[model samples]
Target: MSIDTAPEPGRTHDVRSADTDPDAGAVAFRPAFRAALDATAAAGVRVHEPGTEAYRRLSGTFNITKAVRPLAVVEPTTPDEVATVLRLAAVHGVQVAVAGTGHGATEQMDDAVLVHTCAFDELVVHPHERWARIGAGVRWDAVLEACAPHGLAGLCGSSTDVGVVGFLTGGGVGPVVRSAGLSSDSVRAFDVVTGDGVVRRASATENPELFWGLRGGKGSLGIVTAVEIDLLPIAQVLGGAIWFDGADLPAVLRTWSQWSSLLPDEGTTSVAIMRLPDMSGVPPVLAGRTTLCVRFAWTGDPEVGEEMIRAIRCVAAPLVDLVGPLPYRQLGAVHADPSDPMPVHEASTLLAAFDLDAADELVALAGDASGTPLVMVEVRQLGGALRTGPDCAFAHRDAAYQLFSIGIMVPEVAQGVVAATSRVHDGLRPWSRAGGLPNFCDQAGAERVRRAYPRGVEDRLARAARRYDPAGVLLAGRGLRTAADAVG
Candidate 1:
């Protein structure tokens, strides 16, 4: 909704001015002058800047804290300008942070350049060709709106408010994942600017290494300027959530684990155990109690979908049953994730497979009998298209399931909340996949970064990083192995 189309600033009167021709005039001061000019130019899109109201509007996942304050926010309107900004930043040794719709954001740069790509927003739909070319700044909502008219839809996350580039770059898992695979798996090509400032196009045929690295590898390799991905012919879907009372938690969780595995490839499902706080916006029946919510989305016939979902709905006594036919645009309403952000602490672990023991452990830590105030604990069943790797680059193709825990930080009970969440993770550690989903991993460090990709995939990404960023100016968090160290 926020787009800035402004004219460039006129020359500034200072001690020195950049030479009109870099080869001919004022060589001594032109470099500094150009740097200053670039800095001034970059200030237009900063959300935290006082007078820059547009920049200030860019909110993060947890809006309670305004922690990140960048030196300048740059919104490059074109791929050329994106490359220009990256090159200039590289030459000036300026650190850069790439952001889209700032969900899943964890860290902040002290005095670095933050690239805000909202201006680069563009969505080109090729319905007959079955693909979409989206600008890095585009959100899932825009793409959905564009593609809906043609009976096609892109692979998007649970919430359409999230950005395409950031979501797909992190291996997007959504309602349709079981049938279509992760969002990254749908990527056909990408336009990116590496840390060294080169603007390049990567695909299975072009820059194959870069293409492979970007799919599952987080933003470590470079900033994606544009992405082209395949679309599926799915308009109306049978999807929504069915809620059950707290007393039914044990039956619901156990039944869901077994039921989810039996789901056909056309179906995707997940279960959430929530201890919702008493609040006005919450439904009265579920406001202050632990409840089990089984969410399902069927990409096939509505009748078949309903029949499949009916088995679980009958698992226990129902408190609310809203699962039925709905337009794809109504996807966000299914989960009803909190729109207003707060200080949220999140952690996730992938599983090799979920067995009865794992289900029992999850119930013990977060179920009604556990007395944990953890907002919601979710276990998304992963298989079907998600289990098999497409010919492309995404690496987490073999993960059997994903477990996520989200909790708001209450100052008075912060330590207890942390302990409870840790207990949940520790309980599942025995069966947890050593890796994690990049979209859910929020800790900012090198070790956590490595956990997003497999060892072989990490080594390949490191090699790509070396080929592009030889200077090693970009510091990807946690155990980042540069191209040199990758060789042995």
Candidate 2:
């Protein structure tokens, strides 16, 4: 059973000698690690060394801006194997980071042991129970396709490709958020392995504290193996975007903001100013041009939705109108996010109010006339069901709008993106709230962690982290370590 002697049935390779370097502080605990690795390998785990091709492929993320160089990347096929990885990391004094689709890449891993959950692709839908059990690696698109035939829908974010577990753990906000609330609010249970190497089922009736912390705490608490979430009885929705020329930015933005404030709970909307590149997949009219896109999603009657959206339609002459009734699976068209992988830097804030002055400020900074380097600046309306969700770790319930900006991470424009994002934040400071959505805070610092949660929730999360992960082996949100230390 020695780690170096033989490879188990599903185990890929033996532990290389280079991985046992004595000078390496945490990963170099040789004697105890051999036993831990042997046990994990015997249980069908594959441990890939730093320079190996498997390690390189597993260490990469969807956010190309972050270059993760972990000490080792472990691929665990079953929940037992996941527990073994955590136990091995704890015993060897090495940190562990979970990568599920790698969309939300933060600077939370440094010389840590990364667990790639891509192989845990399990998806089962219970039409009678109106719930679905999805693996940590399953994407929203897969869930959507599985539930489509049953006239059900998962509360997936704008991009259907985003990982379900990561999105739900971070309090996912999607196109139907105003109607269905956060994606986390629908979770019935989660099968997770804490830093202590214990597999526990968390739910409202089970480990309530762990459930609350995991709902909005992201990966700071544990690595989720599978999640059971409630699905909605929604088959179709009247949703899409109406594009207008940049010349009408001011009028369209102000009109949409004012109109959105009067919208009902069934109608959700957002406005974005995009500077799309001239790529092949991009429409010729929108490519390389500053455009104003007004996105809307209505769960009500299609006729009523059309009547309600007519006010914005007549605000200014639109360049294109693609809004109409469509199946719920086509929700991605509402935002039209880039599907290709590219390096990007993003910054976001929740707004207390968005008035004419806020619109003017946005136009002066990121509008067509501003000559900004940022690609897209979006303002999404918030409230309704989103404000009435059950008390969880998610904060900013009373915020009126969410403002976020994204820019390419090219070497020539990296500094420019940072400066422009800071300027945008400063310009909208008057309307900005204290906290932001957990999913949108892309940086890895204590201040960003504090902003993701409210005043009291952070303390509770810190205590939970100490109780569940005393050794701090889970490095997904190491910034929260500062909060835990302050409370102690």
Candidate 3:
């Protein structure tokens, strides 16, 4: 494929593999990639060289992985250039890891080609048509901010800083998911670079197989450059968090589980058990306390929304009732996921339903009186539009709820935290869905992914992978049944 008119004007021959020396590796491919990146630098693409100021900024902003270090970071300006980088990586036998906003980054990639798509950021609104064309590098913040002027919004996940591509690819379930469906469901098209180093467009009518795989494939298929999605007419949200003391956590959690079941599709909510350390960002009252937080988001009319949220709020008097009319940009405060990166070991299992019996059991596992938790134990309500799969290929949309546990691996208690989380998951097995969410898993690999996608869907996705990645060199924990099944 021909390169886009990048300022760096990279028209060099492929680099051959050299010795393991860092200097050798840098001399081998760094200059070529830099040239390509330089060509696009004038086009809003920023190239970060090793040991440079720009490189440090890029690395620090996405320090999601603790061990792995990228050789160099390349921010490509256009889809063609992204495809070129993939082709170059494949030719050089170098692994390529795509980084969006780094919200779901799991591993570090030493000596790998890191493509930071942030330079591709763009959010174009079509209010009258109720649709949007966004760059893959774009974040929920861009969509939320741009759509506000026209009274329109997209289905974005909890943290607005999360990249649109990464979130949507992992099956986005958000506050308004009940009404607008998943972020993937709103997808109209995606411009992506496949493992074969080709840039292709995926839509319902064109490349339908890939369209299905890419939606929930979780970066297993290719690197997306741009996407088009449907937008909703939403100016504001009746959503935020209501915090209760740790002592009232059990009863509050139980009541939330039971009460949320009766909620209509217009309502979305979740319960979190947070043991926040006393820090500058944390509220004084909530700092150093293990608190129970019930978060609510209602997309219906304001009057009915208040009534819907009131049902759960009445379960117990909250120490801090902060739920009310809020702008869409403030949606991150609802979940309050720490913006900083710390070592987090997360596991998730879905429940068939959260009946009263299940609720009691859930509260017992993570309640304040239960024991010291490794980290936060969150129960997010599922169903509603989540029960309905998007028009793409992602599977497992029928789960009732997702039980997510985040255990910080403190030096002395790492194993205990893992054990406690495992015990909790095992205890909830009877009420849990047989599988898990692709996004929530950490190192479970393809066996875990099989549970995420049903059998028929898995077969179809494998075929598409075979078509695009016949050699299996592009494998990065993809849609296959097993890691060994990658090349098939």
lDDT scores for all predictions? 0.74, 0.85, 0.73
Model 2, range 240-310, lDDT digits (tens) per residue? 99999998999999888789989999998999999988989888998898999999999988899999999
Q: Is candidate 1 or candidate 2 better by TM-score?
A: 2
- Give the number of the best model, judged by TM-score: 2
Provide the TM-score for each candidate, comma-separated.
0.88, 0.92, 0.87
Cα distance off (Å), candidate 3, residue 138:
1.4
Query: Which candidate has the highest lDDT of all?
Result: 2
Sorted by TM-score, highest first, which candidate order results?
A: 2, 1, 3
What local lDDT does model 3 show for residue 222? 81
Error of 3 at 231 (Å): 0.8
User: What does candidate 3's lDDT look like per residue over 180-279, in tens digits?
Assistant: 6777988999888887778899999888888988888777778888899998878788989999998888778777877888888888888888888788
Stretches of model 1 off by over 4 angstroms after superposition: 1-52, 59-66, 391-393, 475-488
After aligning candidate 1 to the native by TM-score, how far in Å is the CA of 167 from where it should be? 0.5
RMSD per candidate (Å) reads 6.3, 3.8, 5.1
Score candidate 2 by TM-score against the native.
0.92
